[model samples]
Target chain A: MIVVKFFGIARIKFKEKELHLEASTIKELAEILAEHFSVKPKEFKQFVILVNEVNINKLKMFRTKLVDGDVVMFLSPASGG
Target chain B: MERLTEKTALIIGCGGLGGYVIEELARVGVGKLILVDGDVFSRSNMNRQLMAKEETLGKNKAEVYMKRLGEMSTCSVECHTHFLTEDDADLFERADVIIDCVDNVDTRKLIAKLAKAKDKCFVHGAIEGEEGQVMLVTPDSKVFDKYYKSVDDTIRHSTYSYAVATVGSVQANLAVKALTGKGGKFENKLVIIDLESVFVKTIEL
Candidate 1:
């Protein structure tokens, strides 16, 4: 099971702080989350995805594979000062 | 503490985050501060901006801060009553550290690029609602490009006073560390603060 966490606007929008789900890659996880939240898959693009505290962009981006016990975080960068 | 008396920090924006950052840096005895902001204080700013008050309404933010700091600290404060642009790139060359407290991402991107070009330490701080984040950007850091993209401006996020003060204090602390030669662990990391949930953590970039 992967523990998915949401921060900033993502948390408010998704209405869930965290969820436990099973997925092999970030893309699959996004699909699952979009379905669970009833939002478009494209909405996930706005978040900065991190797998186990490391940004997915440093790995394989959306193709980054996930394993059991991995912690995934979806964070929206804040723009206000 | 004497080291801070010899260091200079350039801060962009004089709003909520900028207001707190300036106050803290001054209180800590940072030698000089160069503030740039074109905006004036509105009634809406009185709630969150430290320098915003009924008397300061409609006055240029940078200028107002300069006057306020002058009355309180020995730190030399300068002001530019105009928005920062590529033409103002020379300011980065004069600062020992560059801080981003701007409200928009485009200006933040510009500060990152300028800091990289000048090889100066850059500290970023921002807040939206109860959520805020701070990051220290070194000359070679690529966290900005990887994490931030063009954001839509249509949706305005509410800003709270406590959130602004929280993030701004962290940013000022990092800048002080950079100036005083104290190593900061926030390089290539984003420190996220959720005031509502009372959660704080750093995510490696």
Candidate 2:
């Protein structure tokens, strides 16, 4: 099980701030959210995913494994000055 | 002037964030500064850009900050009228700290990488609408990649004046603390603010 949190645009679209779900990897987690929310999987790919306070990109991209009590946050890029 | 009088800083971008960051650092007497920006002051910039005065309209942003810093402090201000790049890593080599006032995440990554390589403190700040965030990245920390995660490459946002000032002030404060050995609280954390709801959250990474 993992706790998934959303920020910025993801937060606005999901309507819910966070959710708890069971998943083994970030790819599975994102796929689950895409199905539940009716959003395209490609859109999910664009999100910056962080697992347990560490960026998934720093670990293993979407294949990073998740365990119970892990916190995953989805964030969008900001480019304003 | 107590602790910052001899410190040098590199400010990337002379727009909204840079305007306030430069002013705050100068006021606190950061004795050396490198101002980089490849923009001109347009009428629209007057709203939140502290240095974008009507009289200075059409003037180069970096030059504007250079003149303003010169008038406000005895800091040796060097103006680079272009965007920062890997080639500009030389600029960071001599600075005590680097401030990320640029709008894009790619540039922020460059600065953060250089700061880490040079063992310099990287004070990061960004604003979008009424929301803003500040973070302190030390030599060994990977906070930039952790928090941003290439978000700038895919998302676009606009900023507001209050958020810029608020976040820029925090950036300056962190820079001061890091430079003066006062210690930084956001080294492995990120402080996020939403002025619309008056909400602030600190995330420990």
Model 1, B1-205: lDDT tens digits are: 8899998999999999999999999999999999999999999998899878889999999999999998997799889999989888899999999999999888888898889999998998888788899998888878776678546431357878999999999999999989987746668689999988888998786
Docking quality category of candidate 2 according to DockQ thresholds? acceptable
TM-score of chain B of 2: 0.93
lDDT per residue for candidate 2 within A1-81, as digits (tens), equals: 789877665665676667999999988887888899998776787666778767676799988999999999876545577
Question: How many residue pairs clash (N, CA or C atoms closer than 3 angstroms) in each of the candidate models, in the order given?
Answer: 0, 1
DockQ, all models:
0.65, 0.37
- Per-model TM-score, in order, reads 0.93, 0.79
Q: Interface RMSD value for candidate 2, one decimal?
A: 3.1
**Ten residues in a row with the worst lDDT in model 1 chain A?**
A7-16
Q: Stretches of candidate 2 above 4 Å error?
A: A1-6, A11-37, A41-74, B150-152
Give the alpha carbon lDDT tens digit for every residue of B1-205 in model 2.
6668788899999999998889888888898889999889999887789878889899999998888776776688999999887888888998988999987778888888888878888888877667777888888887678657646553445567898899899889888888888755567577777776677767664
Cα lDDT tens digits, model 1, A1-81, are: 999988877876777888999999999999999999898888998888889888888899999999999999998877899
**In model 2 chain B, where is the ten-residue run with the lowest total lDDT?**
B149-158
